[model samples]
Target: MNRCLSTLAKLDEEGYSAPALARLADRRAFPPRLEFTRADIMEIRTRTAAHMSISGVQEKISLRLHRGKLQPVTEDGEYILKPIPGLALPRFQEDVPANENLTMQLAEQIYGIHTAPNACIRLANSELAYITRRFDRRRDGTRVAQEDFCQLMGKTPESAGPLYKYGASYEELGQALRKYCSAYPVELEKLFRQIVFNYAVANGDAHLKNFSLQQTATFGDYVLTPAYDLLCTKLHLPEESRLAIDLFAEDEEPESIATYGFVTGADLLDLASRFGLIEQRARTILNDICDHRDKARDLIARSFLSDEAKVVYQAIFDERLRALEIRG
Candidate 1:
């Protein structure tokens, strides 16, 4: 684990920052050369002993050859390795530190929402690397059935619009949630917390693909995966033309802000009702999120972000939390 961390840190030092990789070019620094091989991949698979194969090309997924005894990857499960791409990194350079910071903060926030696996290692390579424990695996090594939100709702990755268009409407999603979730107010509260955390962190990228339902044969149903890929992209990026995705049954137009755009408190209330949460419970969830604004602010300040970036983050945090009127 120490070696892995050291290697990642060295990669970041050599200029493989997230922004640089997103932009696909080195800006003020050069990236280090870390060798990834088939043998190393095999070792990672054997040790973590998870049976899975790399399935996509948009991002590269490799097995970790030597992760020590920490068992970074889950037992008999695969791990995802997203190397920072050269081009995309530079495009998002200014926001890199903030994005990374948000990822860490999000992991903590989700602890209050649901049982998310730990995401401790973030690589500073040509592209920002996010490693996560694969939850869609059984104790023995069978791949539990899993469906990307996009595919489940009959959409493709590329066809996904600027806003998230690859999934079912909020109404449809709510139905699914009710079927899969614990059907308790406490669980619903956690879901609300997740929504608030995303908005508070300015994670404009929380589209359908970002969240998914995992189908476990043992459990005989689908459930939300512990949150993964939780990062703040809006703070450093330019204003987007659309919200992450429409949450209610609104016009199919793009939205500027996620919360206020098509989905309002009314929409949230509707969804909550379907999920078995009463209006007051929903309000309580909002209030709890609002109360955490200061904590979010502090987390941003403590990150490796620049001063200018920190101020930007603070401003966004204040505006969003205040708009929602969340109280401690």
Candidate 2:
């Protein structure tokens, strides 16, 4: 296996191949150099300033991969490329792209958590950026209508408050899914599974803005969008306790407390009932997460995260695994 954390494709005597990149991206060849220098990356970020509307402090630019080169796009971007964030806690900034790539792959490959298809892309300047294909955009270059949970719930900074998106519980997200999605039962289960997966991986930043309802062609209705921004946030914010938002409203239970408390199995069961999942269905999702521990651990070992970050990620996983397994 290529030790390079960016893509699964191997390097031969010639060099690292672009097979994975070719398959996933519009362009076949990797950027002549993963934009290697600070000056080059800064220039890309500057060009992207007008195009980026996504929330968060991470410096990223939406790009149109044109003729084997990533060109900054002010509109209709097909891919979002994020470099190691310039503004993040300490040492973790540099590793976040790889951390997210590893986490997204783990969710998709090991735990069956549907997430945005992503890979680590090397810049010509030697920088690494996490690149994910846009799930909302279609082949013809028309965008599928999609709304983040925040929009679905009518929670805007003007309407509710500055913290509006984070103010609601995860249960509220399920409620919105039920109301908006024509395929409620299935989406609800996916939502529940995602919560467990998020906890198991310590994605403390899986906030409302991070979840969306996308329009699928089979029916002119909404469904949970492919998961994105799924990184182990605990690696960066080690002291942070809460998992972005509450699992349920008024989730003041002692067990939900950070460090000592957790989003226990019972809490999930209760939420599952709210979403109308039968007992067996709920257990199946929980059991899958429990059963996949070894697989998850194995991937973490082979993950692209730095050695120190791997330890933190694994520790967070262990803590969440214990929380998910508890009967109460």
Candidate 3:
């Protein structure tokens, strides 16, 4: 009857389209509401802190598709459930789940960026939680080899200090991909588009851990994993930095940043040159994203975010567009 998180399709009261159901389950059955509330998740997180391998600020738990319903699990979870953050979190905290769902959808459906399959589902308390199927696990339960840029660069909190993940610029990520991925040329474009998309959507948390390389079907060859942990951080932390990390290292930074105190489209094109993309290819990609404003706005309208949150999200996007010089 309305847009569901799975496909944003309007077909069934179950809030899932036929295709979404097929992708999420073999029986095409709608998953029952979660059995636990947000408070329950916080309790479980505290109790299981020592044993849990997954780490993040938000309270989350592993889940599995069991007997046509989603079930919480301690291990071998196929999906990750992120409820609204705790009370001590930033502003507009309750909108986090819906914001993530809509942003991920915009990345995949509108900008053609590869992303983890995600949706917002209601909890037992009727509050929404963001659910994402893990990309690191295969259907038969075999684990794929994956490494975030932090590991790939051999940096740790102890060795590189607490802010290690935010220490490097996005240029270093491209360098890592060039060094590790045999298919460097193709993956470079994907990385570039991802960065541009992040800026467009106000996803300020595109840090080293968020961008990773995964082992492909061919052994020893790794490529950029589908995007994950994407959301409009500006909505929750309005005064934070525009991006998690800088676009270039100090020496390679475009003159525009020093002159204007911000990044410009010309600076991005320069960065593309550093990544081995010719001017034509870079301009084409930039133009393509700029052209998607209408579609992105439409998805935001269809999103489950409250009216006030939607307005804030659109205004942030518009500001980013101007900053990047994509809009006149």
**Which is the leading candidate under TM-score?**
3
How much does candidate 1 score in TM-score? Answer: 0.65
Q: Give per-model TM-scores.
A: 0.65, 0.90, 0.95
lDDT of 1: 0.50
CA lDDT of each candidate? 0.50, 0.76, 0.83
The window of 10 residues in a row where model 1 has the poorest summed lDDT is: 1-10
Q: Tens-digit lDDT track for model 3 on 1-328?
A: 3666676766556466666666666444657378889888888877777777786677888888877778777888888889988755467878999999999988989888988988889888889899988988988989999999999998799888999888788888888889999999999999999998888878889999999999987666899999999999999998888778988887466567677776767777877888998788888888877877888888888888888999999999887777677321
Q: How many backbone clashes does candidate 1 have?
A: 26
lDDT of 2 at 311: 83
Q: Between candidates 2 and 3, name the one with more favorable lDDT.
A: 3
For residues 1-328, what per-residue lDDT tens digits would candidate 1 score against the true structure? 1112211222423323454232222232222333443244345545643434544332434332232311234334344554433235424454553354355444454226543332223432322344444566653558877775665665664565543343455445555566555543554556556665676566766666666777656666566666766766666465752246555555443232353543334445555665667778787776666666556665565554557767876776677666565222
Total residue pair clashes for candidate 3: 0
lDDT at 82 for candidate 3?
92
Model 2 lDDT per residue over 1-328, tens place: 4543444433542222454454356336545344344466568678667666756767777767777676767778877777777674855777888899888888888777777757877776556678877888887898899999888888898998988868788888888889988889888989999988887788888889999998888878888888899988888887776578877777555344554455677777777887789988998898898888787777788666778888878888887887878756
Q: How many pairs in model 2 have backbone atoms within 3 A of each other, for residues 3 or more apart or on separate chains, i.e. clashes?
A: 14
Model 3's lDDT to the true fold?
Answer: 0.83
